[model samples]
Target chain A: MKGIAKKIQASEVETLRLRLTEAEEALQAIAKGSVDALVVGGPRGPVVSTLAGAQEPYRLVVERMHEGALTLGEDRRILYSNRHFAHLLGYPVAHLVGKPVANFVAPEDAARLADLLDHGAKQPASRELKFRRRDGSATPALVGVGSLTLDQTPALLLIITDLTAQKHSEELAAAERFARSILEQATEAVVVCNADGRITKASFAAERLLDKPLEGKLLADAVPMEVELPAEAHHSGVRMSSREVLELVLERHSLRGAEAQICLPRLHEKHFLLSAGPLSDEPGGCIGCIFTLTEITDRKRAETQQTMLVAELNHRVKNILAIVQSVAWQTLSANHSPSEFKRAFDGRLRALSLAHDILTQGRWGHVDFEQLVERSLAPYHGGDHGMRAQWSGSRLSLPPNMVVPLSMVLHELSTNAAKYGAFSVEHGRVNIAWRSDGVNVLFTWTETNGPPVKGEIKAGFGSKLISRVVSYDLLGTADLDFDREGFRCALTFPVPKLRTDALRPLSAAPSPVH
Target chain B: MKKNAEDLSGYNLRLYIAGQTPKSIAALSNLRGLCEKYLSGRYRLDVVDVMADPALAQRDEIIAIPTLVRCVPEPIKRIIGDLGNSDRVLTRLGIDVSAKV
Candidate 1:
């Protein structure tokens, strides 16, 4: 009533002015999409007029837009916010009116929206901001701001788009790029083919392996390899086209790896572990094929070497047995007593074992001379009745064949000194030394500080064996002297460029070391 | 239309809306603002969503939304269009109040 009294007391001119203001306000409200339903004359009676429903097409479009759309007055107050905009913030549409748009923006991203507003940005030009929902959770959004006039008042219109799905696909695209980089730089020969076995893509390694670009060529025609599956294994070892072999691999869900030998131009036959898999476009739908060829040349060579090594091991075992028999036969005849014969046979056996140990350490290749001498006399050192042996020489690389024979000779000399020459006394010592002489090594075993000298050098089985091996096995000569000081033996032997297989006759050796 | 100016204090009003659409919700919020300003402590208001109860729409003789009906003070009156314009709304409702401000 107070408000009514204030209006009723107004002069006639003021009343007219108030009416015009109301009419303008009403026009502005309609322009701002706030139309009210009115009652009008109908055929039956008064009926309600849905003034808003008249804008059916445009309202329908704005109502159903995927992106949130809203209009802001010049003062940054939201004059018209669509249902989509209100729903994005999880708020009632009525509450959004006259609210500043920045109220819904996260504090940090509030400036991002300001940039668009200040720069007068238009469609397709946008700034990214985080929009805070009614629940306080943030949504990353792209905001495009444009100028428009609503009810003759300057306004800004915004279209906000969500960025969740775009971010997810960007991550997916990065992963695909990572996979592509690996394929481009792959080392194994990788080939891609269509369903009809036509080549589509090949890695740089595949191009290098074939010595030509692999596009537009049939995979079988590009790689003309002989199918080298084991003769007794897989199928019959009949000649097969590379196409048929690859299909046999891809057609099955399992059974992929095979052995193939490619004989290329100006190169030895290359061995590879051939593997194939299906390129699938969908579940259980084969779009094409992919093949990887891993070169196994070194492995194949080592396999051949291992077979040869086993054969060599067999020959050496037989030779050792024969030498053992001969030593037992000779030792039994030379010793007067059974105890002496047993002792001599054991010593000779121990000598062979020490030398064999050194050869085995060298993988049956080059044996060191200093290591062999020290090892042969190792048993006679540091005991109550021990013979001190010192070696002083430039180290020599002894061929594998001469190691056993030379070590045996040193064993015999040391045993003789322990019995009569130098090691018979507690303070007696011996020196075994050598020096490299051009192609030959000059080696010596000298004993001192012993009650010595039989005028004659003993012609026992030890001397006889030593001379025989130095001449026959080593292709060298040995000289022994029974001096008053002690006993001395000097030997000279040629050191050949040696290998493990050179000790005996065998098939051609492979070149892959070890 | 009978004014019955002596018994116009307590206003009984019903607003018909289709849904929570922007236009319908704005009509509702604006109408609430108007009633609180002019008929404070003296009005009975009912907000009906026709989508929720179509039978109520038929009972109220509502053809379109949002419809504001003044049922009290006899000779019922209907006024619609932007209730955001409180002066225009009051003028249509036969209440002589200040509309300029």
Candidate 2:
């Protein structure tokens, strides 16, 4: 019986030792986190419970999180991914695991992620990168990376946030800033007023023109002008104060834009063309009134000047027509037949027209004396006249008043020379020249190689025009010497100081001709 | 089919949900609480996520989320919403449940 007890005691000792070894192995497994569950005795019975890692409760928490959570193995292969992370890439959670993390990273950001993983994850690092989706599209994301241990193996933990909505808002804000800057730089004065007619915003131009900061001031006080509404507004008896007009524009929801002219007497008698429109929000609801003021003072002045000039031109044209009518009547009375009247009237009209052409070419300012002489003699030469006229004079300019009468005198002398004097024959020649003696100009005309002159020529209209017109209209004296050999004339005119003072200096020495 | 005694003594209920939405989670917890209080040891509950098994939702004729169907109650009854009010849920499911302690 003692021997049987000793054998039983040995068997019990071995069994206890084996049980203790198994318990130690279980404790080590628990410490290492490799066991999924544990069983312990409770008051009622034995309880079986799972470790937190093996439970689905934490998985639910991760799945419901807004940010994407993922784990990557040391080789950068996805070890685990929550639903949000998979959804960010447009993929199923099951399809994401075991894939290379670089496959979901944009090509440009893959290198950065690879380098980060190569460093084996120390402190948490975050980067803004584009993440490629399963559909071959990309989305901007902010990814935070850190090192973690999964099943005793080093891995990377990533938290991803979608930047699509955030980036969109940022871009919208930037566009708004750009538009505001453009408005600030606009040349037109821009003012924004609220429903109360108080200025909410004013551009730099508006502030400068108003000579005060216009923001927060009443629109009427800022502009201080009498507004002229459209004619239709007048007929409708919608005469409105400046403030009331602004309010009316805002209230007229269907009317988008309106314009009026404002006269600001206190501000340098300035005229501003004010254009008002409702500033609309994104939903197309009117928020406030936007008024733009464009200064029309200079334009108004130019318009007034144009009106006065037109009226003055009308008066002058009527006077000129009367003078032409008198000239036609007088020339007709002097001539006997229709052909004679036509010839004489046409010649005189051409002379007047030639003078007007010179004045017009000079912008109706002053006619150059040399230019007048060359033009008046041009038609008389280079035909049967054979370039027989010679002219020499100091450079001079004539006032508009002197151009017409002087051209007429020159015209009558040339016609007479062609009909009876120097130009009547092939070898006949005429010499016309002038010189200024500081205050008066002495002009002389000589005809040579022409028919002999009568002893005393009758004072016909041509001679009367030459002798009377040049002296009376030019404020000068004239003489005619019809010698038996040729005809000669001399005239002296007081050179107006204004004309001499306004003369442009001669560009070069005059070529000698006589 | 003739009703068996065992089948009549128990309730078979199915809850249709979509993912881990807050409403679906609340409905699930509320249903669990109601089952424990009113039909403990006499009810069988199955939670189906429509996002995971959409075909089940079509088969069950579920139009809206967080719907509970009592399948084995002879006349099938469907309840919608988060089931936050326990009394309302119990009444809607035709079960007499006392308030929880």
Candidate 3:
């Protein structure tokens, strides 16, 4: 009994020492003013005594938190709410408690809250939904729900985070992506550069058009060494260095915007319409400049060609008028009466028009010699008798420059034949033939069965045109033989070598000009 | 009249707050409620907004926000927070500890 009592006494001392240490710790905690709370068994159950420091921090956090916090009962009723939670719903904290949690949820999202609450009971879940406020407005929020115990009863903790700022940033990123896609697919070359003239972005067209990688390179260096500004562009007074030009553009963009045209000679003499504008942030501060280059080479070439064609047409028209004036003067000087002059002038004009028509049909390239001869004699081929003229020649074509003078000579010879030498009477007939001996063509015109010609034909406009103009223009010689039975003419000229490769004779003869 | 003079010369309290933040506003309101029920006209309260006059914070040796300091009535004491627990705050201020609000 003595040993057992000694053992019991030792155990009692150990328990008392433990109690003493606990009392000392409690006293220290109270003296230091760090004791947060004390829980004691009361007659009712248990009562909590909260310290000022502990409760103040929790209240401050609830009042100042950016996110709203709420406690909900198992029945989905609001059991407790912090000041932020009440502020989020535009209600007082006292008013929020005991209210159905669905009152603050949007009507559509309220139905889903039941499922969310059930899921939250098992495990935590997060959802994005809109919440209805006391003021009849809705706000987008990301709500996180987790299970917890409130006053020893099962409850749900809801943390709602506003999504306004996040949504705005996402929309901005989408807009940036859209702008980038447009630049990538654009036909014109586009380059974006920073204030220092360093290229920040280059479009696909810029890579192909500049024929060099543009990104990270200075705008000045992207310009090929061979490219020089045209006189017009220089006169526009953008005569600075390429780097300076970029700087000027960037500076102007900061104020407003600027534009200039640049010529890229290395890219097949391409002309570029360069337009530079500033890239500004939302606050209207310029960050960089965007340079857009559009190739106008084809358009520029067309304009130059049009100018040349107009000048050429003017020169040709003036020469044609001079020729007509000379023809009128010659015809007036030879004829004694206005009627005679009118007849000669009219005939010459007709001849000129016929030559022009043939040239036009050939695209002003060349006229067939055989067709010219036949057309000149077609008017005289008519009559009660069949055609009293016969002709034969090797096929040949003449350039446009030679067609007019040649046509006039042929017309004069035909007129002289009809009036005096051949075809003057009903039984008169004419035979014409030509042959090329490689270097020269020999032509003969023989008149038969007609009244004999006089001793010498007067030096009229027709005869003068036939001899002087034919010889001078064709570089050939012509002689008329006033034979008693008929008048015969012989002509000789150098035949141009046949350009068999570039041109071919028409396969079929032209239709007769009746 | 002697009792009124003694009450007029009672506790001098200064509350340091940072702006009109929710914690500061709650602290000010709760402190007023506590003073009205306990100290009443017997205490002088000086509310200092640090955001408006930041220099006052350094002068008071304030380390935390919403600090209530008892400057007069001898042996100055400080209580930090929104003064939500009236019993603790009243006891720390040498006032009736059993005061309820």
What TM-score against the true fold does each predicted structure earn? Answer: 0.51, 0.52, 0.60
Query: On residues A1-514, what C-alpha lDDT tens digit does candidate 2 reach at each position?
Result: 9999999999889767755644564455456543333334446543334344444677677888999988786767676677888888898654555467898999999888777666549788888878999888889998888999864878898888999899989999999788679668989888888878889888888888777888899888777655565544533434445677677678753221233454455575676666677877799777788888788888887787677667656755765576577668778778999998899889988988897788778755666787898899887776755788889998776777677777887888888887888888888888989989988988888999998787677666777766666666677887877777888889888884454533322111111100
DockQ of prediction 3: 0.04
Show where candidate 1 strays beyond 4 Å. Answer: A1-69, A73-125, A129-141, A146-149, A152-155, A160-176, A192-200, A215-220, A223-268, A273-292, A303-311, A314-322, A346-514, B1-79, B86-101
Clashes of each: 4, 0, 0
List lDDT for all candidates, in order. 0.72, 0.71, 0.70
lDDT (Cα, tens digit) per residue for candidate 1, span A1-514: 9988777777556757755655564455556555544344557655545555666678778878998888776767676777888888898665666567898999998787777787663433578888899898888888888888765867788888887678768888998787567768999988888877788888889888888999789878887666655455467455556787667656643224567766566435677877767877647777778888889988988898788778877767777877788778878888989899989999988888887777777766677777787777776775654547677899677666667777778888888887887777777888888887678778888888878575665567777777777877777888877777777889888855545565343332211100
DockQ of each: 0.18, 0.02, 0.04
Candidate 3 lDDT over A1-514, as tens digits, reads 9999999999889767755644564455446553343334447643333445546777667668999887776767665566776787787654555467887889999868777777878999988878888898888889889999854778788988988678778888999788789878999888888888888888889898778888899888775322233345432533445566566556663211223334355664566556667878799877888877777777777777677667656755765687788778888888989998888899988998898788778866667888998888887765664688889999867766667877887788778877886777878888989998988778788889989665765556687766766577667788877788897878787785444543322221221111
TM-score of chain A of each: 0.55, 0.55, 0.67
